[model samples]
Target: MRKIIAQLFISLDGVVEAPDQWHFPYFNDEMGVAVDSVLGRADTLILGRRTYDSFAGAWPEREAAGGEDAPFAKILGDARKIVVSRQQLEFTWRNSELIKGDLVEAVTALKKEPGDSAIAMSGSVSVVRQLLAAGLLDQLQLLVHPIAVRKGMRLFDEGDAPIPLKLLSSETFETGVLHLFYAPAEQAGEGTYEDAKAHLPQDER
Candidate 1:
């Protein structure tokens, strides 16, 4: 199964929306580099309806507007994306599909499908929450911004169990952001994962 990895940008106070600004100037060199790095790590894309709508209006025309090199625009133009939407709609971006189904089931099927690259979640808080709650996420990459918003949507919603994470790596950017990589902690004295799997029931592991 392809691991579903979530790469998110968040503020110190847990705001996922508009870390650059609430209204405009959404791109920055720091954000661009971060996204480009993550894109190199995955192939499949999944997004919620709101994020899809927002992206559809922006990326296709971005090249003509001299923004094709933008991290999202470049990837959206090429990567295979499953846009989770109930309403049927034609996609403006190339290599995109509109998936209208239960988010968890649909994502689960996608992960099960044979693929070389890992799946990734971007810009969609609702979809990210669903993946995290379902225990579908294999790794988390967070670029933590220093700003604190009074109120806004966040990356992780309620009902998230305290699944322990082992810190894999951490680095700071010139913008004062911290890039943290985390994966589920390996149990102490645990043998190879295959050996561990044989001992624990599939569901428990």
Candidate 2:
């Protein structure tokens, strides 16, 4: 089964929107390697309507310009893109297709397909959240920056049901950005204040 991975560039306050505005100041070779590692494993890209539009408008142009970003742009342009949207859209980008039928069903079927490579969802916060809630997301990879944006569209919204995740691995970059990889877990462990006191210093206890 192909793993469905959701990769995001998030802020300290959990904001995932507008990475371009605050994301690059901390960029380094380590972060580049981490991002490329995730992209290298995925042959298919799933995106929300907004993210799809944004990429469609920019990456193709960048590819044509043959700039420093062109190589990465070509990767995005060549990958099979599945766009999720309720309303109809005209797909101008090559190898792009709108998702058919129910979102969960479509993604479930995609996961069952024969493939060793991964299916990656990048920058589509809503789609990621939906898939995570439906128990379809296999891995959640986050590059958490040290700064707080304070206001923007966050990954999790208010009143959302609690979802438990287990850390698979983690690494810290010199820029103070944390690369965290997580997978869904059965349930979150519970403990009381008195239970926590067991590990406290003798004087504090």
Candidate 3:
């Protein structure tokens, strides 16, 4: 089964939007190198409707223009992708598949499929929330920018559902971006409800 991996850029405050306002400068070569590295590792891409639209509109043209810093050109052009959108338009990217259904369900289905290459979810902060709430994300690659944007979208969104995680790895780049990788923390052996009650003591008054 393929693991659902998420790659996102976030501010110190967890903002994940444009990331250019306060301090997160994408134009810096140092920053670009950090981003390009993350983009290079993906073999499969998943995106939400809004993120898909943003990427499809700009990256394709950028690739055609032959810019050396086309961060996602190679992968986005060739990797298999699943876009969750209700836009009702056929995908134009190579090996792109449209998924028009419930977000969590569609993602869950994808994870169950047979594949070896790592599956990456890029951008799509909203989708990240849904997947986190559903406990569907197997791993996360968070590029925590040193500069905090103060405004715009956030990487991690709060949901009513309570889910826990374990920090699997951490890395720091030259540009001050901290990459954090996490895995879903498996529940410890607490046993059944009866076991819990037994631990509470036998009707101790």
Candidate 4:
């Protein structure tokens, strides 16, 4: 069985939207190491409709332009992408597939299939939340930034039920960003993130 890893860039206050506004200044080699570690483990990319649309529109052009950052764009361009959507997607990026029926069934099947590790990244908050609720998420990675955007889409939005997690590992970068890795705990749906964070060491946390 393959692990479905959901990764996100989240703010101190749980905000995950428009990360470009506050995410770049903090980017450093340490963060790159964390990102590379995740991408290195996955050959497939899972995306929500919004993230699929946004990445499909941009990454291709960026790859074609070619630059110092082109390798990352190329990785996305070459990887197999699966987008989960209710409505049919008219156009899709290269090497991409669409799942338009029964999100849970489709994703669960994907998880059981033989393949390299799979990863889900930004703009997939709703999908990730549903996966957590269904216990379909195998791992969750959060690059916790230091600032609070105060008024943007939050990662842990209201109405989201608590999902328990066991900390696999955590490392704090010099940039003050915290790289947190978690696996769905056996305790499962019993506790909130605050409860989970409390389990981390005061220094590493």
Candidate 5:
């Protein structure tokens, strides 16, 4: 089965919106490698309407201009893009299509389809949240920048049910950005303070 990975550039305060406003300052070669690693594993891209709109508006133009960003734009252009939205939309970009039927069911089917590469979802907070809640997201990769925007749409919102996660791996870049990879896990154990005392530091104990 192909894995469904959700990759996002998030702030230390958990904000996932408008990375263009704050993310560029911290971009480095390490970050580029990290981003490329994720994109390299995925042949298909799943995007929410908002993210799709934003990408469609920019990447194609960048590809046409043929500059430093053109290679990256071409990567996006060549990949099969699945746009998820309730309203109808005319897909102007090549290899783009609208998702059919229920979102969960459609995605579940996509995972089962024969494919060597994984399916990637980037910059679609709502789509990522829905997939996470449905237990369809196989991996959640976060590039955690060391800054707090204080105000923006965050990955996790209030009143959400607790979703346990297991850390698969992590890395720290020279820029102080943390690359965290996580997978869904069983519910975390609940223990009393006395039950946890055995794991406390010696000084604290």
Candidate 6:
């Protein structure tokens, strides 16, 4: 089975929205390599409607321009793109498909289909949260920047419940961004995940 990995660029305060406003300064060679690695891992792309729209609007043009970014643009343009939406969409980008059904079931089936691991990118918080809640997300790669956005859509916001994550690895870039890789922690003793929270650090608790 292919792993469903949700890769997010978030600020110190957990804000994941509009990285365009605060993320450019930190982009460096290391970050480029990290992004390339993520793209290399997936032959399929799972995107929420907003993210899909944002990507479809730009990547195609970049792919045509042929520059340092052309490789990523090609991946975005050529990968099997699945946009999760309830309404019909006229896909302008190549190799794009619309998924309009029970999100959980549909995603679950997609993950089980034979293919390389899939990666989900920005502006897909709601969909990512659903995958996390349903235990469908196999991994989460968070590129955490040092600066805080102060006020924006955060990855973990109000009303969000704690999710257990076991750290798999981490790397620190010279630009002050941290690449944190994690997998879901196995359930402890059959109780709810909240029950396992007792073992977490006081600051986290």
Please list the Cα RMSD from the true structure of every candidate, rounded to 1 decimal place: 9.2, 1.7, 6.7, 5.6, 1.7, 5.0
Off by over 4 Å in 2: none
State in Å the error of residue 68, model 2. 2.0
TM-score of candidate 1 to 2 decimals: 0.76
TM-score list, all predictions: 0.76, 0.94, 0.77, 0.86, 0.95, 0.87
**Which digits, one per residue and each the tens of the lDDT, describe model 5 over residues 20-93?**
99999999999999888877557899999999999999999999999999999999999999999999999999
Per-residue accuracy of model 2 over 5-124 as CA lDDT, tens digit each: 888999999999999999999999999888777775578999999999998999999999999989888888888999999999888999999999999999999999998889988899
lDDT of 6: 0.85
Over the stretch 33-150, how does candidate 4's per-residue lDDT look in tens digits?
A: 7777776456788888888888888988888899777788888878778888888777656888887579899888888888766665555888988888889888899999999889
Across residues 1-205, which tens digit of lDDT does each residue of candidate 3 receive? 7787887877788888864355445346655665565556667788888888787887788878889846468567777777877678777766778875887878778888887766788788877777877888888777777775677767665656556788998877767778788888865545788677766756657
Residue lDDT tens for model 1, 139-190: 8888787777768887666663555678999978776778898876644553
Give the winner by lDDT: 5
Query: What C-alpha lDDT, on a 0 to 100 scale, does residue 85 get in candidate 2?
Result: 98
**Alpha carbon lDDT of each predicted model:** 0.74, 0.92, 0.74, 0.82, 0.93, 0.85
Q: Show model 6 residue runs off by greater than 4 Å.
A: 119-122, 187-205
Clashing pairs in 6: none
Ranking by TM-score: 5, 2, 6, 4, 3, 1
lDDT of 6 by residue, 1-205 (tens): 7788888999999999999999999999998888877765578888999989999888899989998889879877878888988889999899999985898888888877886566555558888888888899998999999998899888975555668889999999999899999989865445776888888788744
Q: Predict model 1's lDDT versus the native.
A: 0.74
Candidates 1 and 4 compared by lDDT, better number: 4
- Superposed model 1: Cα runs more than 4 Å off: 20-30, 66-72, 185-205
Task: Report model 5's TM-score to 2 decimal places.
Answer: 0.95
Candidate 4 collision pairs:
none
Candidate 2 residue pairs in backbone clash: none
